[model samples]
Target: MEERKQLKKTLKPHWVWAIAFGSAVGWGAFVLPGDWMAAAGPLGVILGFSIGALLMIVIAVSYGQLIQKLPVSGGEFAYAYFGFGRYHASFCGWFLTLGYMCIVALNASALALLIKFVLPGVAMQGLMYNIAGWDVYGGEVLVACIALITFAYLNIRGTSISGFMQFIFCLTLIAGLSLLVIAMILHPSSSFSNVQPLFNPEIGAVSAVIAIIAISPWAYVGFDNIPQAAEEFNFSPKKAFKLIVIALLCAAATYSLTIIATAVAMPWQSLIAQETVWGTGLVVENAYGTIGVILLSISLAMGIFTGLNGFYVATSRLLFAMGRAEILPRVFAKLHPKYETPFVGIIFTCLITLSAPFFGRQALLWVVDMSAIGVTIAYFYCCAVAYRLFSWTSTADTDVIVSPAKKAMTLLGLISSTGFFLLLVVPGSPGFLGTPSWIALFIWIAIGFVFFMMKRKDFARIPKEKLDYNIFGKTLESESISSNTTKKEA
Candidate 1:
């Protein structure tokens, strides 16, 4: 069973870096810069993201340690199991599932939005219905479905193919974005003077920056993805930390540059304040005409493509991990006989993502808001696990000698992860969920509970040693937890 569950080891170091960087710099950077600027202004976005990246680097230290120890497909899911046994693993797995799937779905829906912005009236051919004050269109849904299917196939074909494509996409995306920033610099009308105000007036500078800081888990969610594919790395797993940090820095710079590029194209305040769906697109269109939009299109397409490709990989591996543990249906654990990819898991994710476009563009925000909560929950689990592993005082199995500095980083990771969680759930908080988002979040939690209950009996029957083999490929009796309780979950 363990052998059957193993995935191919074809992912190169550069390919791994591309997965993290490419996934982190997704549709959100291009499409939501104006919204971010409206919420926190240009300087706030820059400072907020830079600081957020630093915090994520702290978290990445925990991930690096855990990945070096476990080096599995489940990433945080396996880490949670190693630290606190099965129940906490379930909690981490279920929530991270939400984070990964929602991002995948969001990117697919974003593809439709990209089409709507680029081609305009073309996707409006068949008006399906009105959803969240946004019109649902059949043409848009079809386009999103096709894109989803194409990415799903690319993944199912083999990681060698998909991983190679991700590298190419990352290169093109960086080059295209570099061109956008350069064009903004040379444009006659573009000026740093436009970014005069650095804060949202209503919220104040401190509050606005804090708000952006709170969403760090969501913004830098994909860097954690390095661990998700760590098991597939063709290079040393020890290099995972450096790759994650490198990706976080690059992603932060990309986000800041994109926002600054938009602001410098015209007046920052006026561009963001305008009632336009695609404010950055409008800025480029007005300033540089079709040439600008065409340039923007390359970046946008690569962003969306990389997002779809990357998240699909993360979500599938997670489901595959959970399925192998029998927390989910065993079918999810199945792999393609030929490609050795997680085809069942891939197909399952694709099927779920297919419904996203039908909900219309506005619905994507609700999912995005809700996913922050999920990823933040997973972040807390990962950091907490790392803290225990490092701070374990028992001399038994003291082979893992962690430095004081590394231990301090894990503590900071815990604090920052907790802060991220509080921001999302706290009422009137900057990252608090709206009514629609709360509703979606609750429905997902309820479904997870239902699945847990239904599988409770079957899971209880599995022996702990067998469960360990299914998940980590061996019994982890040495991977002891430092917690007070020794409760085990099936």
Candidate 2:
């Protein structure tokens, strides 16, 4: 059989960066922190944002180093394969893909929620009618399902088109955020007092720090997304790293300002009592009236759509990478003959995402929190790999340099991410209440290990030397020899 043609490496640097930003910005800015704040209080939100952003930078930088060293489509899986082994890599890839799918579903559900704000009367009336004995939210679920299907179809139609759509959505989101900033600045109630220090001396600084780190996990949620685009990035790890940083900065600024604006415009007591996810929208409405609410709802909906599309892209690529390594069914590796996209995997992901809305909003949040746990586990592993690559290795590879600053950052990041994961697993915490996220991860990894042993012979065919680093720097002769040997042996 003829070898399958590789995907076209056509995404520009800007789009690559936008994907990372879009993935991080989604419903997270509007929804996630409020939930955390409600649970912990304003003190928690303040501490969480500060510490979370700091920890996120460490993980992003480590990933930057890892992607520079090994720019492959597998993200955490690719790093684990080289640093640990095929089995470990497969486990990371599978979990990461699963997490992305959950994010996609979460985004879809958020979009549905936003729709109610935009058309409350219609939504409420639909709920009263109780089509199929459900409610308007059920109708919203149907709408979100349709939206996911439409995007999946669009993605299969072509990568360039999908990328362009994502670009437009991202630009619209940024423009909407800019408008929000202007509105908040012009609001009669706006003041710097909204940004008061969250932790007082009486709060016990050390305990406050721990609480902040625990809450901040929401802010660092999307950093793993960059590595998933390795193939589309032409293997340029440095460029990818810059994109991740830029995205994180944009997200942090938006989050900090949003929190401050909300606190300033609305009383802390009222904000804390908000049980609805639409609290952000309510704040915008109060600040600027109907137009402000419309803009906020539209921006949030766009953010969710763009985020879902980005996650679809990343998750499909991750599955494709696993399939290429024979850890998953070969069908997942198949590219559309004309579009050169992973059509099957994308379709499957959309189906899963569409089905997820039935779980209700809180249940959906629990799923996302669980997925976040998986991502944190992946980040911890990536930090370890970064430390190993930088400290223990003597190779002349620029990507592996162990700068004292980077080392310190990586160590801190490792500690923060690991501790955050433990916090998530605590009873009464988001990940602990419903399904134990850690337990789910363990079961998922075990399944991957079983599959790895079943296909150990196929994995052995690809030599350790060839798989050690990304396909970027090797000489032409070395590439040819490895390619020929693998083909002949297979």
Candidate 3:
């Protein structure tokens, strides 16, 4: 008989922290602040993000508890299975995969966008066809593909290399951005007078903060990535919550600080009016010329790299977990003999992202917009699962009863997650998805249902016991719960 394969527990707390923090603050920090500033002025943007980050902390509490309880690779997939059944697990896995894969692709294209900002017209060479009004170019495609390949290879090599790289990149990103922000603050031209309006006139103070809050799902996505890598953590699961909370605080500060840095540098109103390709870069350039651009470029590159690397780890691990549970093809679960990495899933993510550059950034944005819905759904699942699993107990033993406070918090997370989902899908809402994104979303849901039908019998016959073993490494049990519910509760 062959030995059952397992993922190595090589992830230290720092690497895990890197995966959480580095993933949450991606290329959006450097590139999108100007758009955010335009919609909401510096104070509005900062306050909105600060509020959003706090809400995310509430949602993350459920996730932290689950990581402590489950400690599995599939994240919400495993949680959904334990709480509901295989059907919900399949649903959770399908949508979460969309969110992760789209971000992986989105990050690659962000790299191309970064390059174009650094060297104007360089990515415009060898004009390819245009999609959704954004032209594709051979130069941009080559750059994105090269990045996809390099990161895929690194992931296939092993988590240690990728995790270490992410840690180093995150540190360098912090250092570079710190220097750039400090330079912007100290430059002779910078002035408090430049920030004339603390809030945008068009969006209104209240409305502007609301707008920033609506996009919170996208801005803080990389942190939930912790649950996906929980199976690899070398430390006690007890420590996962601490790392997640710390990472969340860091990410919140980074998003808020980046905007402040840009707003303080120059007159953001004029920068937005000019509509430069990259307003943040332009701000730094106006402050210190070539030297400022170089500093910003290095920072932006590191930000992009961490996003790319972090999502690659996330997407691959989710796919690997699903495959091991027979939710995907068995091949996706297979590991590289030498490196013991999920090479198949890693390669699959790379191949999927490689095709994204061809569609142009405009087209890709539609998918990303749709994907926020997918991630919100996953958040809902995690909180719901946590609530059901921890709220009530089956045993008569007083010690086994979960605290009322913890139970209430999970319910709050569930409700907030549901709100996040509604903000995206509810028509007439400020954060509602466009027609294209809605169409893509329905099509994706339809496909998930169809795939479920094809595997319906297999899912039924496999037995939940076997699934627990396959996905969780053993049949998980808690002394307080017998069948996730007690006769008294039922």
Candidate 4:
């Protein structure tokens, strides 16, 4: 009870939106646009993202309903726990946890590469070795390690400080993108016709859109992070729902404009042919020279930081939830006496992130694809759980009411998420994830299976009375009473 009182609710409504939006945008905005444009062409990429946004909207509705209804820290895990059962909940939470860690690793590699890009020979001076064809450097690895530690420390200190940093980084990214778009519009050399090839011959129009859709989940994965921090929100649960929707919409717009600006500045064919994947930087350099590179690089830092920091917060909370439930080791549930943060989880996550920089960027890209698969599966499961809850709760009085329209939306989310997952693994689909991605997915699943066997007894029988009832992580008397009622009903 004393420990529950230590977890404070300090995140404001706006901060919730900022963190979600910022996390969703991430380093993908700057790096992946070139590939997205190449795969789907400018028009096709835009159309695909629009379609993707609609699909996400459906999923967001389900998440909104669940978050408001549960108002718990473990977002997806909590939904699965209440709707399905402990065993299913652990599976859902474990997969999402793996997905979040993959993303954190992805961001770490991206950060190291970005440092090498901006700093040049400074980090690249000593070629430590080679991994998967990319040259590894001790200095670059050091930079990434330092960054990982910094983010972990920030989160360990407290959520309030971390949330504030997220807001600032998000604003900086928005400002940087705004400046670039304005500059592109004003450039005398720029042309709207540069986006001419709406679909490329190599991937075709349908395939292009499908490819974008295949990766869309990762590009917009941050909205789900909102629910992980639900216990920290200061406003009503309904506001948290609205903020998620708003954040995704904003992310969709930001991505479209960023792609358009890049496309208008440089032809898609030219970008595809570039030897380096730093297409966004090259486009900015083409339009505004060194000044543009510097601006975009700064924006890139903000984008990368948002994903790194937001996911750091998210993955730790996830570990905390699982640990508290005795699904994972209880060490993950340990909180700092002074900060009341998940210090053990944070450190464990940081140690995992330490591996990504060594494997280099290409390896992390495959890891991101694998992460997308896991996230898609988790989304599919959550949609199933959400739909079930909608049916079961009709007669129950709950804080979050699911209307007929919301119910329909949840069904739509289930269909779309299922379809998206199929597109990833289906044999003949245009967006069939490649061999490496599948291999990675299988390996992750195997590891999870091993862990599950070790905890089989706990999974077979969960102690509902022993479960933490302070959904908001607060020790209010009313919350304890409500929790008891909930456990009794269960």
| TM-score of every candidate relative to the true structure | 0.97, 0.84, 0.95, 0.92
Which residue pairs clash within candidate 3? 23-222, 24-222
Per lDDT, the best of the predicted structures is: 1
Candidate 4 accuracy as TM-score? 0.92
Report lDDT per candidate. 0.86, 0.69, 0.85, 0.80
What's the CA error at residue 217 for candidate 1, in Å?
Answer: 1.3
| lDDT per residue as tens, model 2, 1-490 | 2244256776777777677777777877765545544544456566556667767877787888888866767788876665656556766776677678888888887777777777765444344233323343556777678889988998888767777877888888888878887777678887646534454344554554566566455555665767876777654667877878787777777676666655666655566566655667777787778998878876787788778878888888888777766667778879988788989889889877877766666556655666767787788878877766555435565434657778877787788778778877777643343454455557666876686788777767765444443222232223332344345544
Model 4 misplacement above 4 A = 1-6, 391-402, 468-490
- lDDT value for model 3: 0.85
Residue pair clashes in candidate 4:
none
Assess candidate 3 and give its TM-score to the true structure. Answer: 0.95
Instruction: Residues 1-490, candidate 1: write the lDDT tens digits.
Output: 4454788799999889999998988888999899899899888888899989998898888999999988888999988887787778888898899889889988988888888888868777799899889998888898899999999999999998888999999999999999999998789999988887878888989888988998888888898788888779888899999989889999999999898889887777888668799988999999889999999988999999999999988888899988888888889889898999999999999998898888887887787788888898888888988887764343555644556677788999999999988888999888787899999989989998998888778877887778788888887665557223244432
TM-score for candidate 1: 0.97
Mark the regions of model 3 whose C-alpha exceeds 4 Å error after superposition: 1-3, 392-400, 476-490
Give one digit per residue, the lDDT tens place, for model 4 in 1-490: 3244334788888778888998888888887778777778887888787788889988888888778767767888877666555667788887898889988887877777787877877778788777777888988888888989999999998888899999999999999989988898789988888888878777688888887877778789989999888877888888876898889888989889888888888677888898665887778888888898889888889988999999998898888887777788778777898998989989999998898788877777776787787788778877876775554246544433456776788899999999888888899886787788888889989998899899897655654544544233433234333354456546
**Sort order, TM-score high to low:** 1, 3, 4, 2
Shift of residue 71 alpha carbon in model 3, Å: 0.9
